[model samples]
Structure formats: structure tokens, C-alpha cells
Target: MKEQNNTTLMTTTENYEDYKDTTFDYEHYEELCVKHDIRRFAEVFLPVFYSVAFILGVAGNSLVVAIYAYYKKMRTKTDVYLLNLAVADLLLLFTLPFWAVDASIGWKLGNAMCKITAALYTINFSSGMQFLACISLDRFFAVTKASSQQNFKKRCWAICIFVWTTSLMLSITDLYFSEVKEHNGKHACLPIYPKDSVKEVTALIQILEIVFCFVIPFLIMLFCYTAMAKVLLKTPNIKRSRSLKVLLTVVGVFLITQFPYNVTKLWRALDIIYGLITRCETSRTIDLMMQVTGSMALFHCCLNPLLYAYMGTTFKTYITKTVKRFSSWRKQRTESVEEYTMYSESHVEETSSFSI
Candidate 1:
């Protein structure tokens, strides 16, 4: 039930798409009729999809980083998690152009690049989801536990360190296992997992991925937001409507886009562990569904800054101020350059007249 190594985050940018790059050898994979259609679709659709994602993801995530770095004097506890989330999004998009090229063409890049790109893709994907958990937990404490501002500030860095360390260790598993293998004269970047190994390491890793990426974060968000909504309703000064809106939107988008991909992965993992794959059509359907859902997950990253960060009035103000300041600076620089050119021309004329 393993897919092509690098076609997607869940599938690791996997198999069907690679079939497109290998012309004469397509029949071998064509035996899996559903997969054959998936491969064809991947060739046409994934390249375009990944390209759009790369552009929007980089632009939106970069703006998030900019607002935090240049616009804000000091970041709050929530801001710390949000900033790391942006970094993870940036990292995820960095590997996308490479995958886009692979989907459009093939893994023309060699094994080293295969390892690098796959590892980066896996790392960021895993870490970004983990940060969502951190965000939820931080909010939960802010609402329920009622820590002092100083205590919360101190906890932010410590919690950040712990979560990032754990996620990096989780990510490094891909770095160790990811490899480039030749398939029908084409190269692919994917994890090296044996289906029937005695150790069952591949299945174990897959389960871990579901747990770390989808399960824990989802539970944390659900519980925290539920409690947060309750607390906000009780508070007299704070407007509950806006906070509730943002909370619901954040949770809704993630679950809708993320559930399918992770659930598909979970299904595949079980199929591999128990040998339950009875029909190629069913498997192929899962493949198509996974590809589409995974793209939605990527889209979620693009929306992170908007859904979580920009939903705040304070954050919107900072973004506005930064844009205005940048525009003014650019205008001033243009005027200064024009003035210098005018002065140089007049000085040249005066000097020429004196010489004559």
C-alpha cells in the first residue's frame, strides 16, 4: 500500500505520478487500473496545484514573518507559536517547487536532492501540525489556568523549546529513512519501508505520523477551543463573538482539509499491517482522495496567517502600518535618487561653462 516516495506529504510524493515520466514502462503500473488514472491525473493536476500553493504559501507566510519581525516590538506567548508556525509553513513551501517539477516531469534531480527535499517536506509537515497543538495548549492555559503574565512569558520559550525539539526528533526519522530509488529509468524520493518486515517499523512510523500530526493536535484544539469559548462567553469586558468566530474558523478549516488525508493514511497503514487490500479500485480511490485532500492540507498552511493571526485587530493594524512605512520609504528613496541625478546634471553644466 506504499505510494510513490515523494508525490505528497502523506504519500511522500509517491508512485502514480512517477509512472507518467516512464513512457514504455507504464503498462507495469497500468495493471493497477485505478492507479493508472491517478498517475495520469497527477501529471496534469498536481504540477499546477503545487505551483499555486508554492506561490501563495510563500507570499502569505512571509508576510506573517514580516509583520512579527518588523511591525511588532515584542511578541506575546501566542505570537511565539504563531511565528514558529510561519517558519514551518515557509519550510514546507520551500520543498514544493521541487515536488512540482517532479509531478510535471519526474525526479530529474539526483538522490541527494531526493533525500534533502523529501526530508524537508516531511519535517515541515510534521512540525507545522505540532505547532498547532502548541497554539491550542497555550490558549487553553491563557483562558483556563490563569497564569500571571510574567509566568506565561517565561513558559512560552520553554514550551517552544520542548515542542520544537520533540518535532525535530520526529522529523529526523524521515531523514534517516528517505532515499532515492530508480523505477523504470526514473528516480523517486521516498521512504524506504518494507511492507512485511519482522520489525513492522514502517507501519509503526505511519501510525506515529497519524498520532503526532493529526490526532493530538486535533484533540488539543477541540478541547481548548471548547473551553475557550465557554470562558470567553463568561467574561464581561471581552467581546465573545469575534473570538468565537476566529476559533470556529480555525478549527473548521483544519479538520475539513486535514481529516481526509490522515484518515486515508490511517486506512493504508492498516491495510499494510493486516493485508486487507482486496480491490485495486478501492485502493485507487483512496489514492485520488489522498492526493486531493493533501493539497487541501497545503492550502491550510497558506491560510494560517489569515485565520489565526490576522483575525486580531492588533495584528491587522501592524500589517497596515508596515505597508504604509514601506511605501513611504520607497517613495523617499526614489525622490532622493532623482534629486541626486538633477544636481549632477546642473553641476556638470556649471563646470562646463566655467571651463569654456
Candidate 2:
């Protein structure tokens, strides 16, 4: 019996070793995962991460859109760009429920849904980040040259169209690389590429995203913000208005919310390449760390709307009014319920006394 068990174990190990080279060898993955307890990690944390992401994401983006749509005066050129950002964020949030359900309930949603959801996810991520880059460049030019603002405003619509179109193309790339497959008696959408090519493609795309959408734009934003800060500081002769403070806060929040995510992404790309080439023994640990760090970037979808509230004056006012109205309604509902309960109790007491 012991000899037979040993033979079974050896056969399984040999099969797993051969299977790793295949694209959809989720069975092998599952074996390695069981040996290392990967599902335990997912079960413990994925639900919480996605729930927080969805709730905050939906609320924040909705509020931003509400404020922007409500106040016509808030539609400056900059605000229009922010409106686009808000729209992208909202679109992304709209898909979070699907992801949340998938994480909790398993992939009951079908191949069509898998592809559509994947497309939406990629499109939003690419479009949203690219829009951020465009906004950063616009700011850089506006600050660096007086005439550039006029040119930027004129070209803004064209730039937006380009960003969205490019994003749409990039997002649809998933349709080519990924497929729906059954695993562990459940369906999953996974990227199917040669082992080496899969790693290469992942690294290539991450590098492209970090370089074009993150590092370059961040540097531009850094320069603009630093220069702006210097001008604000040195110009002691000039009085800074509340509006100037507000504008600085807006730019500052953008840097704060986005910078860490970009830095982490760049580092993650390097880590992936390093792990692959060097066959680093620490690859597992690095991958785990990337998962945590990537969540920080994922949370940005939730943070974008908050930035609009902080930066846009009209949004602040509108949110305040909305919150007050909600509070008033809650109070009235509570009072009405209490009053009904008291009257019901008195009627019951009187009936009992009359019967006595």
C-alpha cells in the first residue's frame, strides 16, 4: 500500500512538471497552489478587497458626476477634463459588481460575460490612465508657455478622442490573448500564451503602461507642481487667494493618489522580468507582494471621485446639500416610526383595561 501511494505521488509530480508549459494547465497550477495554500490567501482577503473597492468606488464616482452635472459654472476647460476622468472612473465602477460577484460566487457568469467584463476592465484602465497623462501634459504646457493653454484647449477634444480610441483598441486585445476554460469544475477566463511569451507580453505591456502613461506624465506633473510651488513661495509680494489654495490642493491630490501606484507598477514590472531571467528563489514572495501593491493601484478607482469633491467647489456644495437632505429624511423616518409604535402600545393598554 505504501509503495502504491509513493508511485501515485511521483506520477502526479511528473505530470505537473510537464503540464506547467501548457497555457491552460490550471490543474498544475491548482496542484502547486494546494502544495502552497494559494486558495487560502484568496479566500481570506479577496472578498474584503473587492467589497471595499466597489462600495467606495461607486459612491465616489457617482457623487463627482452628480456635482459636475448639476453645476454648469463648474465646466471650465480643466473641469471638462475632470468630467472625462469622472466618467471613466464611473464606467470602471459599473463593472466592479461583476468582479465582486465573481470573487464571491465563483464564475457563474458565462464566456460572453467573461470577455465583455475583461474588455471593460482593460478599456477603463487604459483610457483612464491615458486621460490622466493627457491632463498632465496639458498642465505642463499651460504652465511652461502662456500660449500653450489656448492651443491645448483647442486640441483637447481631439486628444480625448485619440485617448479613448487607443484605449478601446488596447482593451480589445484581451479577446485575442484570453479564453474561457473550465477549471476545478468552474469556468475561468485566463490568458493563453506560451509560457515564455506570456511572461514577455505581461512585462511588455506593464512597461508600456508605466513608461507612457505613468513615468513620463508623472515627471511632467512633478516639474509643473514643483515649479508652481516655487513660484507660489517666492512671490511673497503676491497674495494667495482661497482659489489658489484650492487649485494647488487639486493638483496635489492627483499626485498623492497616483504616484505610489505608478512607482509600484514600475517596480513590479522589473520584479517580473528579474524573477523570470534570474530564476530567483524569491519569485513567490515577490509575486505575493505585487498582489498587495497592485491593490493600492486598484483602489485609485475609488479615490478619483474623492479628488473631484476636494478640488471642485461646486461639488463640495452639492455634496453638503445632499448629505443634509439625507440626514433630514432619516430623522423624520425615525420619528414617524417611534410615534406609531407608541400609539399602538397605548391602544393595546386601553383595550386590556376595558376588558378588565
Best by TM-score: 1
Which parts of model 2 are misplaced by more than 4 Å? 1-35, 137-154, 183-186, 194-199, 237-281, 324-356
Model 1 / residue 254 / CA error / Å: 1.2
lDDT of 2 by residue, 8-107 (tens): 1221111223234444453544444431333335434556776788788888877777767764444335666777787887777676666545544456
What are the candidates' C-alpha RMSDs? 6.5, 9.0
Cα lDDT computed for each candidate against the true fold: 0.72, 0.57
TM-score per candidate, in order? 0.84, 0.71
Residue 192 deviation, candidate 1, in Å? 1.9
Q: After superposition, how far is residue 181 of candidate 2 from its true place, in Å?
A: 2.6
Give every collision pair in model 2.
Answer: none
- Indicate which candidate wins on lDDT: 1
Provide the lowest-lDDT 10-residue window in model 1: 12-21
